[model samples]
Target: MQPIPAKLAALAQQENLHFLLAVESGSRAWGFASPDSDYDVRALYIRPSAHYLAIDEGKDTFEFIEDEWFDVGAWDIRKALRLLRKSNAVLLEWLRSPVVYAADSAFVRDLNTLAPQYAQAAPLLHHYRGIARNALGAMDLHGEIRLKKWFYVLRPLLAARWAVQRGGIPPMTLAELMADLPPAAVAEIRDLVALKSGQAENYRHRLSASLIALTKTLAAEVAALTAPAPPAPATAPLDALFRTTLQRVYPC
Candidate 1:
């Protein structure tokens, strides 16, 4: 964690950007990181006010990937807000991530407040289902499967279930999403997590019949769900927040 905070700070300085929020957006944040898992740091930043005013808007993203261990990325605040308006799953997860590397408290607070208002169940359900389908597709149901990849399929299947049943944004952590599962399913998932924690990312093992069964059940249930599309939220509030953030970060 020491290296990460310093790295993020250096990134902020190097890019001359004001970081509004930064957090672990991958396995570490989701509470299921293997011993060798790398940091997936994601952030939202504000460029100099003049950059926004220029006729040619500069790049809105920053990415730094060092080897296979440290991966850091940031989205300019304006770009983040536009995605937020459409309830982007990645942005939604970032706002709820358990591990924070950096933050402007007020900005993060305001953004979280506005998140639920814009989040629509249908899109999020679709997003999670797609993730599960893709991950599941990569595995061999009758043969050996990448053990770690099981989580990739399970997490989103459970998230889709959570979103459909709860009618809201799903919790970011897998443990939270498992709270309401039947005992057998929970036990199987726990065993898988324990095995995954000590193993390398490419570890392979026979797929658990029960776990795969549960995955198929949950996937079918999510696919069958029909949530009404939520009404579009007005952008006035987001616009105000954007303006206010600029003023707060760069008072003139």
Candidate 2:
């Protein structure tokens, strides 16, 4: 479980990937996992200088999948930021994950310094809203409420709350986000999680009508978060973060 980061780092280097940033971002990062949950590993890497000289852009990203057992991918910073600006929550999860296996310590340390500069509320709100809607729909339609669907709904809502509190991107883990909510809210989340424990993989659980109602309210909360437009047409920060971080961390 723990050595994955090192293995990923080694993979990147051996493949001549200009590895920059790496961290735990999936079930392991989230804290509570089904005994059978797959390890989801994600990272960002770049190409060598020669590859950059070519006419074609390097592969935009890399993907490796192993059934439902493991998934590891690397995104070009551009791809990442586009998703981030569109409210990609996974990126936030990586930034906030407590279980760090590997990191360009200084690279992450520096990125942390700049996180707030680009942490706008509007994009994140829109992102969370969409995410909650999708999860809530599953809960509403499934009749048998999926034990996992609630977490999907809960994670985004907590993320929205975190974004609101910090005026920056929020961590995605249920536990980390709880600290930003009221004590009562924290208790509520814990109870719900415990109630759903046997459900990690069941994908079917019953949500009380009250639970459905709460999920709806989360949608409204997502709507409340909105961002001001950038001064000019601009790219999502994911690219710059990737390029600079990679160059900085993996010097030629």
Top lDDT prediction, candidate number: 1
- Candidate 2 residue pairs in clash (backbone atoms < 3 Å): 77-238, 77-239, 78-239, 81-238, 122-226, 122-227, 145-205
User: Per-residue CA lDDT of candidate 2, range 170-249, in tens?
Assistant: 76678877785568666766776665554456656676665556666666766666656533324545456666765664
TM-score of 2: 0.79
Stretches of candidate 1 off by over 4 Å are none
Candidate 2: regions farther than 4 A off: 77-89, 180-185, 195-200, 208-210, 230-252
Question: Lowest summed-lDDT stretch of 10 residues in model 1?
Answer: 207-216
lDDT score at residue 97, model 1, on the 0-100 scale: 93
Candidate 1 Cα RMSD after full superposition onto the native fold (Å): 1.4
Candidates' C-alpha lDDT: 0.85, 0.65
lDDT of 2: 0.65
Write down the lDDT that model 1 would get. 0.85
